[model samples]
Target: MNAPFGARGTALVLPQPYLLFLGDTTEPGFAKTAFGLRDWAGDKCVGEFALPGATVTTHLARMTPAQAYAEGARGLVIGVANPGGMIPPAWRKSLVEALEAGLDIVSGMHVRLGDIPELAEAAALLGRRLIDIRVPPAEIPVANGRKRSGKRLLTVGTDCALGKKYTALGLARAFRQRGVDADFRATGQTGIMIAGGGMPMDAVVSDFEAGAAELLSPDAAPDHWDVIEGQGSLMHPAFAAVSLGLLHGSQPDVFVVCHEPGRTEMLGTAGYKLTSVEEVVELTILLGRRTNKAIRCGGFSYNTSALGAEAAIALMARESDRLGLPVADPMRGGAAFDALVASCLA
Candidate 1:
């Protein structure tokens, strides 16, 4: 993969099936997101490796990186749910091995290649550029100069990991369940993932309406209830204010919050510390209130325990009610989530 950064023009030779690094078990259990991606790909080709209980040092040392690379693999997606224990030099060497094998690297969480000193040369090895997602909040232009209707609105966010995809998907799914002619799309990561994988224009546009367009334009899809996901935390340097700005700009009828309780204190790659769920929620509340958009429901990671789910749903509900919004009860499944959305519009 030759990297000249920008979402403009990207090409992949499909070197092998996508290789996903699941990171440590503390990253929200990985059940729902993994299952979703697995189903989306229609194959169980994702490679799951266990990170050391406290650090990635041991894992990086015993590497035959070439062994992980598949000649047919399309690219590699490294999920650094935790970076606390990561050894920069060791991790950098492993990444270099993967690049030498001709693998296009896609990183998530706090795996910023450019941030580490040892990895500078390695970062340069694969076109000398890392994929940095930095979308800021802006207003979307309406098509044909049509003004937006004030009443019905929709919004969504991620509570844990990249659960924003699920939140966005659930909203779109809920809209369809209600027979509402709505479409789905995501701006940041998911959009790039789809477009890079060769998704069609209509689908991409629809996906954006579902979740991505809200960041840039307030009226990205005024006629349709758009459900978009937030990248990570405000504290995250690479994370942009634009993601949340999109939801505010759209003036969503309701905002759906998705999160994983397990990620509160996850140990990440390269010994970098990550914020907890409680901390993240605090940041989220600050950002959520930044725009006039109101949160309608809160969705938890699939791995949330029954009791944990109940408590989270209740806490979110109380918060929402305080804000005059509604919270979704996960026990009712996706349909229940959808019903809550429809009620919000009512």
Candidate 2:
């Protein structure tokens, strides 16, 4: 398939074309990279390559590494963000096969691919590059709680994989289409890969995580909108600190809460019940007020991929009316997002 034009009607271009490897799992952790790529790098994605006997997710189009290479793909991206951030042994063979075929590798896992001797040797022999996206930045200073000029909008979630980055990107796109000077401030690997620059918050030392956000959105023109991508969740058992740090560092003028419609629990944790969207919004606003007392809840981005089109639209409407705020699925195209952007920036 050909690359599609972005919102500005400009053709999308990548430094190097690649295919994403999602293996057999389409769970939230494993499938997020592919979804992010599709949303931001649509033209650059040749197709997804899955493991043998793996079931492809309904939304992603599947193709073999060879097929992708035939169509100008030069690398394979390890797209899963599994628990523990380690590559599964079952996926080793497929990765090796791709290396043997001269495809470079890119991964965001905590386990660096170049650290594996065999994989390193294969890449060296094939003269291919192995990019590990989770590597910590060289020098991240502490945050001083300094103020910035532009209007900042942050997307915080009730849990990981709840589409914070997607929501941020969607709003940035919407703002741009409306002739607003909006920039997406990515804070994770997948988001960095798409935006071409961002600190990987999880890899940074705890003290510097918030500092990274402070540096990312340094004073821009007052007309600019810095749509900062959030990481983790305030209520998540595993990564709450990181989430709080980002919230405090961004000090957004407005924040949006993102949630999945059918989710009942925090991912990767047992017995942790999911909080209602209203509760999550209130908690985020309360926390954000420590940095900016005037911080407000702009809207919500509800993930309704599991539902039919009609059902999703109906659900969005009901939530919007009940919460008295705009609601939308970032992946589903609609004018609701336009309203959300306006409300947040106004």
Candidate 3:
């Protein structure tokens, strides 16, 4: 397989047929890595392994590490985005089992798996590899604010787990269906793994976060659209800086606001009420215009997973009517995403 370009223009080629480990945190943020791998890697995803008590997503079968190894899993992927990227102690046994089975381990967490004594010893004894995708490039240049040709559409969110990457990818696919040349610029670990290229924005130093976005979506023809994946929310106290840097770096011509309907509070932060969709749209436009004054809101990508079929439909209709913009659950392959692409093209 051809190597995907890394953040620093280095080549990155992972072993094939990976076993994605989604332990406990099956929420969108953590489960996203598995979804991305399934979508992009296809046959390369041999199996998925989850903790015994963890709630698994629909259509994903949970396998043991030994079973995964027997079924042709060349590597074990720690796909969850746990806080601090630390591997939970309960997961060590499974990881150790995979290591003993001679499977290389790849993780996108901030915590390096190689630093853990037991796991490190197992890998050393077994001669298996440990790769951490979150490590920043050795060097990243600061943004120069240079203008580029091409229509750029960025997906900003009300919070971190709001589906910005999915929306961006869905819009890119819809644009391709319409015979438009478009590219999805991934900005996180899940997206990078899916797209096979892109910088993990949150892993970069503050000075070069935007610079990474700029590099991801370089100059293209005016008709081409760079569907850039956005990072965190402006209101998310912990991740707001990364979001702001991505906005300033992308310098998009148009942007889409993404939110999870009926999500009362921010993920992992109780009592923190989500901002109104309208408020988020306004904020995205306000921040986007700081780099490009002509920036406008293209539409909205709504995550209706928390709602049932009827409720999701009703909320979609209401949000569409209320916002007077196209709204879609991008993961569901809804026609509304086509409208969103049309809005961006307009």
Candidate 4:
């Protein structure tokens, strides 16, 4: 799980009023790092910078490295993730400029910033920090499987890059709005960037994945809720191990299925059809029962960002009726999402 934006974690402290670098990215999905920051932690971001050919935008004011630094931005976050998670040589010039302008470099890419000669030398010469969000802690204790005191609601994905993090963030905010103490427990680098601190579930050793998750959401007051961001899909052929380990460690009292409507196939995979919501709910319950016998699905969260307002609402209604569970696009807060919050509390 993660902390509130700007929250201090001993390992890394990302300075606020940041500049988001979109680099040469043209794909929206690849620019998730920027979108996530803009959507969830807008207050911490000051502006955006991108290479000339880039079409993607976070809609923040466009700025140069010096301009952003002059505007009080303390860091320049690499806000894109390509297939290999590697820093393109084309992006290094802007990174070095940001360092020369007195902004630290922050990244969620798989490649460590220190490994890149240009970024490493620039940061070292300029006394700037290179923060990598994907790195897990040096030691993660093995999960004991003992039940914890706090209540938890995990968002399980039907596929990767759906709505798990957004759902948890919205749910956690809703819970606190209703006077319940809650925290958004993040599990990915993007979630970690938005929430400040989290264990990268996919980065942890397989043997310690469950342990990392356990450390993520610790025991808390009985009434408190840890709205956890989920990792890969349990039905995802290549990434199910991390998902299963997270499920076992989270031992959620409740979960919400997060899906993107109209997607017929798994992302980043060929010929693998998407799993049904019913299948996800059933399987999650079946596997999750190993940890919490009372584990149950609270609702469904749809990524309706690509759908029209009325159409999105109608789709959720039909699905909710079919599944006999509350369904919503938490981003479209209304009676529907309120009902979802109610169901989780119930």
TM-score of each: 0.49, 0.78, 0.80, 0.89
Identify the leading candidate in terms of TM-score: 4
lDDT for each residue of candidate 2 in 20-130, tens digit (9 for 90 to 100)? 888767575567777778768777778888876655452556777778788888878877778888887888888888887767888878899988877888888888788
lDDT for position 87 in model 1? 30
User: For candidate 4, lDDT tens digit of each residue in 1-346?
Assistant: 2344333232234666689999988899898789989988898899999999999998999999899988899988889999998999999898899999999888888899999999898888878999888787776888889999999999998899888989999999899899999988888888777776677899889998888788887778999899889988999998999999999999899999999999889988877999999999999999999999999888999999999999999999998999999999999989889999999989
Error of 2 at 96 (Å): 6.6
What are the runs in model 2 whose C-alpha is more than 4 Å off?
1-15, 21-32, 46-75, 80-104, 122-129
Q: Model 3, residue 177: displacement in angstroms? A: 2.7
State the TM-score for model 1: 0.49
lDDT of 1 by residue, 70-160 (tens): 4244455554433353434434555555666655565433445566665456657565334433222223232232234433333333322
Candidate 4: the clashing residue pairs are 1-185, 1-186, 2-186
Q: Model 3 over residues 1-346: C-alpha lDDT tens digits?
A: 2223543473233555788887776576567677778886666777788776777552455677778788888888877777666788988888998888868888888789889999999999989998776765556778888888988899998988778988888888788778888877777777766665567788888888878777777778889888889988988878899999999889999888889876778877757788887888788788888778899998888898887877787778777888899888887655676677778788
Query: Which portions of model 1 show Cα errors greater than 4 Å?
Result: 1-17, 22-45, 49-72, 83-87, 109-111, 115-129, 134-166, 176-225, 230-244, 253-327, 330-335, 344-346
* Residue-level error in angstroms, candidate 1, position 7: 8.4
Candidate 4 RMSD to the real structure: 2.7
Q: What lDDT score belongs to each candidate, Candidate 1 first?
A: 0.42, 0.79, 0.79, 0.88
| Candidate 3, run of 10 with poorest lDDT | 1-10
